[model samples]
Target: MKELNIAVVGATGAVGQEILKVIEERKVPFKSLRMLASSRSAGKEITFMEKTYTVEETTLDAFKGVDVALFAGGPASRAFGRDVQAAGTVVIDNSSTFRLEEDVPLIIPEVNGEAAKNHKGLIASPNCSTTLLVGAINPLHQKAGVKRIIVSTYQAVSGAGAAGLTELEDQSRQILDHKPIHLDVFQHQIAFNLIPHIDVWQEEDYSKEETKVLHETHKILDAPDMAITVTAVRVPVMRSHAESVYVEFENPLSPDEAREILAAAPRVVLQDKPHDNIYPMPITATGSDDIYVGRIRKDLYNDHALNLWACFDQIRKGAATNTVQILELLLEKDWI
Candidate 1:
């Protein structure tokens, strides 16, 4: 692949840092790198692959001569995604701002990579929760035809960004010392509790995060009519997200058949061995690149339904790694 010029927006944020790590680890060929952040973080120095680069404030002309821009989400993406694209850079955005736009493709390379070819200069990455849920099930959906989905997500605090992690650690220590708990990053005490609400409430009383899972899954898998319901819970874990998924397929799909199909699925690792106590968990998946799946079984009440567990490092595979993979796919196929 030819080396191209690359720019990373939100260079000082959580997902931005991981995107650098992934680019280094994956050896993405980039002739030049532009580090961009908000004005508050601008002028700070970051070192990557033995090279020190200065962070610049994102601007209309910031993406000049750049080949691809990997956005780390938040206000930056909403503010400048189209600007960067208009400047002739391919934008792989991690924000929800452009995801639902009719012309923009919501891509999860493992599930709908080919759809990325239809990009009109910008591509949106799915939410981390949606990424984990779809990563484990899209392969099954392909084999047995998913009719409906019921999912409960146990998301890590890091999903909220660095502030979320600090809140958990500080609050845990505060509770241990018997001090007044501080609530900042989250709505409640996230140290020892589970917040059933993630993002804000949307239509039908579902949190915005839960809504993303439902809608993004349909977009990525190209299953617009698929039935999906989600309950998103923010757990106290520092990293990685776990989900308990129940899928009802149009055709009969046994547990053994599901395992066989998932085991061979791309970017998936099957860890099903409950008798010996081996299954997918947040701790095991924290720094891993692959989504871990286990606890496969047939639903007790429904002959057409199957249950399973899935775990993934939301920061890695869900956000950073997936963004980089999209660029990699285009490079390998010479589509960029």
Candidate 2:
């Protein structure tokens, strides 16, 4: 791969920082790096790969001569995604702004990566929870034709960005010391409690996060009519998101057969050992690139359906790492 000039929009944010780490660890071929954030974060210094680079305010002009720009989930993508692309830079956006657009391909390299080649200078990554869901199920879907999906996500606080993590830590400490807890990042006290709400309410009483899972999965999997329902919940865990998935297939798939398929699936780690009490957990999944799946079993009521648990670092594999992987795909295919 040729070294290309790269730019990162929203560089001061959590996902932005994770993108930097992934870029370094994965050794992305880049000739130059430009850290672009909002005016509030402009002029700040960010050191990556042992070199300090001053952050620049994101602007249309900053994209000149840049080969690829990675947008770290925000209004920045909506504000500058197309203009930057028109300037000849390929954009891999992490926001929902362009995800459902017919022109933009929502990509998970291990899943529907080839769709990225049809990109018209822009591509989108799915929501963190949606990414984990499809990563675990797509392989099985290909083999047995998934007909329905019911998922409940136990998402970590980190999914809410840096504020969520800070709020959880602060509230936990305050509670431990018998002091009143502060509530800001979340709608309710989230230290040791679960909030079954994530994102704004949508049509038919679905939260925005839940709706994203439904719609994005349909698009990415090319199964718009596929039955899917989601219950997205916010948990107190610091990182990673876990999903209890119930999948109904057109053809019957046993737990053992499902494990056999997932065991060989790319970027998916099968940790199914109920007797040993080994399964996917947030603590073990944090900072990891692969999605961990376990607890494979037959659904009690549905003979054609199977149940399983999936977990992955919401910040890494779910957001940052996946964004970079799309870029890597573009580079490997000489599409950029």
Candidate of highest lDDT = 2
Cand. 1 Cα-lDDT: 0.92
Off by over 4 Å in 1: none
Residue-wise C-alpha lDDT for candidate 2, range 177-208, written one tens digit per residue: 99999889899999989999998999999999
Which 10 successive residues of model 1 have the least lDDT summed?
Answer: 327-336
What is the C-alpha lDDT profile of model 1 across 1-336, one tens digit per residue? 789999999889999999999999999999999999999999999999999999999997889999999998889998999888887899999988999898899888878989988689999999999999999998898988999999999999989988888899999999999999999989999998999999999998999999999899888888899999999999999989999999999988999999999899989999999998999998899888899999999999998899999999989998899999988988987878
- Assess each prediction's global lDDT (C-alpha) against the native: 0.92, 0.94
Q: Itemize residue pairs with steric clashes in candidate 1.
A: none
How many steric overlaps does candidate 2 have?
0
What candidate 2 gets wrong by more than 4 Å, as runs, is none
Candidate 1 local lDDT, residue 280: 95
